[model samples]
Target: MHHRGFDDSCGLECVENGHDSNKFSLLCSGSAVTYASFSSQNESKAKLASSAAPDSGATKGGSATKIAWEDTFEVAMQRARTEKKPIMIDFYTDWCGVCKQMDADVFPKKDVITESDKWVSIKINAEKRPDVAGAYGVTGYPTIVFAEGTGKPLSVIPGYSPSTEFVGLMREARAKWKPEAAA
Candidate 1:
């Protein structure tokens, strides 16, 4: 099948051909579109570390605060449990403009990256992972779900938010997280 490139205005370049297994594959510049299960803890860690580089616009020392996004929700949950940090799931769709804006403009900011480092970050394509999206009741694009290390949700913020606002929401969610409530 012939796959045309995504809109250049969106800053995504894809010459995709087809899907692989249950995961959708798109070759985009500086973006990941695979959702395969991780084989081992070491492999997962290596992947996370390698992909945690600061965005090109980031200044010196920004890499230290970069958020390491997991490839899958399960991996994020496992990492959260192991690291005793909260899980922040970013539910987005490739076609959602706001989602793309968040990816391009908001998430790359230094503050957002620094604050997000405290959590186990996971980006899920809602359209590709309908089951997971439905389970979280995500009806819109760019839904940010904050949960405990055990995967029990703490707060759900819907719609697109600027980097500062998003960080504030994250802080509020973290403050409200109750470990006992998850049990």
Candidate 2:
């Protein structure tokens, strides 16, 4: 007979040799085992930790704002055109689990936010902006669209991605659609 032991916090099992009829035994297991670890307020926390104090002269909510964008499509379009930056439109719904996960896991990462600053980022509520979502054919939550120039679609990324992959996606978009000088 063979025996195995593990600490209280660890998750491990003991198994007899292949010759034995019974395959294995779970000797010890962890109290909590989650596939994903993140929270909705993660973005706000990350921005607060990474961004500096807002300057008195700073316009609008300043750099510390999470999901930095305006609700108005016209304003977003104007910013994209005048800033000569690529537009990144995020299609999301408040009730979506995956969308919340994206906000918690992906958007909070320093690299994702930093790289996103180069583009004219916008967030469109799938429910409130159903026309925009329909126009872009966004059939899923957390759909990300990289638009080149004014109102020109370049690429669409659908679904929730981890921080590293999300950063890579943004980098790829930047490479494919270089930003023009700000007006």
Candidate 3:
């Protein structure tokens, strides 16, 4: 559902159909909306903002994958448990400047993408996943955490890094969490 020109503190409510997978896309005109929802039936809701949604030609690699925190916890856990590959959780906020810098200067680069493909990549909004952020002790924006499991914390790379440096960090990520070593 798209909402434009909403108030700064406006709230939203959503209801999902149990039979069908509920896919929700919400767009706000500016950064002035507050969305709230309650479900009567037991159903999961995945929200993608207009700004965060993939744009045309933004990502060069076709295989660059993105998973929100809420939907992929189980898959993340299973990957960590079965494959023994650590998870890289990117704690980013939509409006954060450094996060955008990392997205542009580091994450989408060929080297970073190639290196990141070795492990599970999760893009988590700190606003959305406060618990995960707190669990990892994330104190700032664009904090990257490498963990052997979803709930476990291993190593952290804070602040913005260029592509090459970020690749080195990924290598360190591999070294720190041997489970996430390149495949």
Candidate 4:
């Protein structure tokens, strides 16, 4: 994988491959060479955008409504337990294109935000929180797991989904979740 337009500060050279035109390789200042998939390139772009403008909710079209992400999984779990709402855990990696797409396109939509308000929405970096990711059996990027406050999973959605489809999935999770079952 090769990516273009990395900041000059990093002094990274983007090299295009003949075999896989979609993929690219990044040569750092030193002898280190890193290969990135097409999807990973998108993720890198998203990360750059996020870090460049920390307060800007910049999207493809314009500014987007940001979701109020919880600080930690434990905090979200406690809030869910207290509010009697199911926990919506987003398992994602920084280098996932689909995850970046969801953040930029699907998650900021009005329908998604409104539907998600009923649950304790939490976003976890799978790489950072390997323990939680391992416990939930999350093997893919952009995995949405709906679980009870007690951390029992009711539904798991893998991959990127449109806003309408995502809302339907949320409804199904809500319908299947039983607060009393957590006891």
Candidate number of the best lDDT: 4
Task: Name the 10 consecutive residues with the lowest summed lDDT in model 2.
Answer: 31-40
| Stretches of candidate 4 exceeding 4 Å from the true structure | 1-65
Order of candidate numbers by lDDT, starting with the best: 4, 1, 2, 3
In candidate 2, position 118 carries an lDDT of: 78
How well is each residue in 35-55 modelled by candidate 1, as lDDT tens digits?
Answer: 222343334234333443222
What's the TM for model 1?
Answer: 0.63
Q: Which parts of model 3 have CA positions greater than 4 angstroms off? A: 1-71, 180-183
Per-residue lDDT of candidate 3, residues 30-74 (tens digit)? 221222222321221222222243222332222755222323455
Measured with C-alpha atoms, the lDDT of residue 66 in candidate 1 is 55
TM-score winner between 2 and 4, please give it: 4
- How far does residue 45 in candidate 3 sit from its true spot (Å)? 35
**lDDT comparing candidate 3 with the true structure:** 0.55
Across 1-183, the per-residue lDDT of candidate 2 in tens digits comes to 643334233233333334442333223242211112223234323432453321223122225444465556778788878878887888877655556656655776677777777777777888998998999988766688988656677788876567887888888877777455233
Model 3: how far residue 83 lies from native, Å: 2.6
The weakest ten consecutive residues by lDDT in model 1 span 53-62
Identify the superior model by TM-score, candidate 2 or candidate 3: 2
Whole-model lDDT per candidate: 0.65, 0.61, 0.55, 0.70
Candidate that scores best on TM-score:
4
- List model 4 lDDT by residue over 1-183, tens digit each: 443456565444556666767555555453323344444555545443553211123222122355556768998888888878898898887765556767766787888877777778788888999999999988776788999988999998876567887899999999999987644
Q: List TM-score per model, in order.
A: 0.63, 0.63, 0.59, 0.65
